[model samples]
Target: MKYDQIDRKLFIKNRKNFMAQMKPSSLAVFNSNDIYPVSADSTMPFQQHRDIYYLSGVDQEESILVLFPDCPKENHREILFLKETNDHIAVWEGEKLTKEAAFETSGVKTVYWLKDMEKVMFELMTQCDTVYINTNEHYRANVETETREDRYTKWLKQKYPAHAVAKSNPILQRLRSVKDPIEIDLMQKACNITEKGFRRLLDFVKPGVWEYEIEAELMHEFLRNRSKGFAYTPIIAAGNNANVLHYVVNNQQCKDGDLILLDVGAEYANYSSDMTRTIPVGGRFSKRQKEVYNAVNHVKKEASKLLVPGTDWAEYHKEVGAMMTSELLSLKLLDKADVQNEDKDWPAYKKYFMHGTSHNIGLDTHDYGILTEPMQENMVFTVEPGIYIPEEKFGVRLEDDLVIQKSGEPFNLMGNIPIEVDEIEDIMNS
Candidate 1:
């Protein structure tokens, strides 16, 4: 791992919280993500399952965490099963975690090798009446591939047909939504790294530069700051390309009067920070371009203030739509007739500003939070508002990561990153 070691107390605390919610004799299991295959000999990079990482802080593949909080054997209550390492395997691939190192990484004192998993699990399962299976139940989840967790779940169910099964997703969704102080600090670090990348591009972007070049510059800055590149696949859309919401083929050359929409972020310690900033290609926005940019910026600022606690996710979006509708009308993007004749389901502002204003942002880009529930304090979200004008050959978006506070306004994680038009212009020219 390129990032520094995190304090294990966070994981210990997370496990304690999760165990508190479990049924009396229930045991929960979490498996690490598989190192997927690319072709014959190649393999994609391994990403740790966030739930297991939250509980054990083990970032390696072929790892499992078993939480038997009510077990009679005290040492067996929290156990970590890791792939055993030897000198020969260490020479082939870098050293895997040793038993002592596993104990240090996670707070679990009991460690067993992968070879002993079945035997250990058999003994542990007999003591517990219920099993909690970790499943992907995030709102945006569209997983088709069967994960390592899925295989383990299948085997576990087949082996223990009599045990009661429970879903771990609901508990995790609620718990992971609210940010721990330590998690907030890690996300702040990611946002700070992203800020460095954005500032680097201010001077580097010229009229004729390729969109991919800007992406490269951001990658370089993020890596130097100990970030593991983007939180998601980056969208470096130049000019009309920005109209396509998920545009990632950054092959176009930025023209003189066009704007580049950079939807990018940096990941630190597997935590994510999401940001989007649209800047003028030639370091100066045209009169009409500035008008659209300011409107989006205005909407962004107004939308951010609405992210306080007790806000309903759906109602918050409806309010943002009303805010954006007024802005679009001011910009002449929507007429009075357009507003009067718009559908109740899809408002007039949908023509210019289509996507949602915000989403939960953390370990996953779209982190875990129940949309149906009221907003809570310490929840981090991305406030991104944009106006895509294909006819004018430009688009404008401004985004920031914010933490909802207890009483007042949410805290901006990217507060130091330049967003004001004057600040951006001065930095680009300086």
Candidate 2:
């Protein structure tokens, strides 16, 4: 891993919390993500399953975490199964985690090789009446690929048909939604890395630079600071391209007076930080450009303030829409009559300021928090508000990662990064 080792205590605490919610005599299983293949002798990079990493801090392939808190054998209460490593395998591939190293990394004293998994699982299955299987249940998840976890789940269910099955995703969704102090710290580090990337672009961005060049500059800054590139596929939209929310074909040369909407972030230790900033290509916002920029900035700030504890996710968005509506009216993007005659489901402001104002941001760019539940302290979200004016050939968006506090307003993770018009102008010119 390019990132530094995370303290195992965080994983230990996460397991304890997850176990506390499990039914008695229930066991939970988490499998590492598969090292997917691209072509013969080629494979995509191995990314650890967030659940396994969250529970065991084990960042490797072909690993499993078994939590049977009320097991007959004390050592079996928490066990880690890892792929065994030998000198020959070590020479071919990099050295895999040894039993001793696994123990040190996961704080689980009992470790068994992957070859012994079936035998060990048989013993564990007999002691537990219920089995909790981890599944992808995030709101934004649209997975079609059969994951390693899916294969394991199928095998486990077929083998133990008599056992009561339960879903682990619900518990994880609630637990992972609220950030632990350690997690918040890691996310802050990611945001700090993203800030470095954004600042680097301030001076590098010129009228004629290609959008992909800016992407390369950000990648360089993030890698040097221990980040593993973008948290998600970056959106380097220039000019009217920004109107397309998911524009990523960053091949165009930024023209003078056009605005570049950089919806990018850095990932540190698998934690994500999401940010979006639209800057003038020539380092100076035109009068009309500044007006739209300030309007979006105002909506972003106000929307962030509404991310405090007790806020409802759905209602919070409605409030943000109202805030954006007022701003659009001021900018003449939406007329008073347009709002009154607008559809209740799709408000008039959506024409200029589409997309949700905020979403849970953490390990995933669109992290897992139950939208039906009220907001909680320590929950991190991205406050992004934008005004896409295709007619004017420009778009303005400002986003920041924020942590909802116990009291008062949420904390902005990108507070140090320049956002004010004057600050951005000065940095780009300096």
Report clash pairs, candidate 1.
Answer: none
Per-residue lDDT of 190-274 in model 2, one digit per residue for the tens?
9999999999999899989999999999999999999989998899999999999999888899999888999999999999999
lDDT assessment of candidate 2? 0.93
Would you list the C-alpha lDDT of every candidate in the order shown?
0.94, 0.93
Clashes of each: 0, 0
TM-score for each candidate, following the candidate numbering: 0.99, 0.99
Which residue runs does candidate 2 get wrong by more than 4 Å?
none
Q: Residue-wise lDDT of candidate 1 within 297-384, one digit each (tens)? A: 9989888899899999999999999989999999999999999999988998998889999999888999999999999999999999
RMSD value for candidate 2: 0.8
TM-score of 2: 0.99
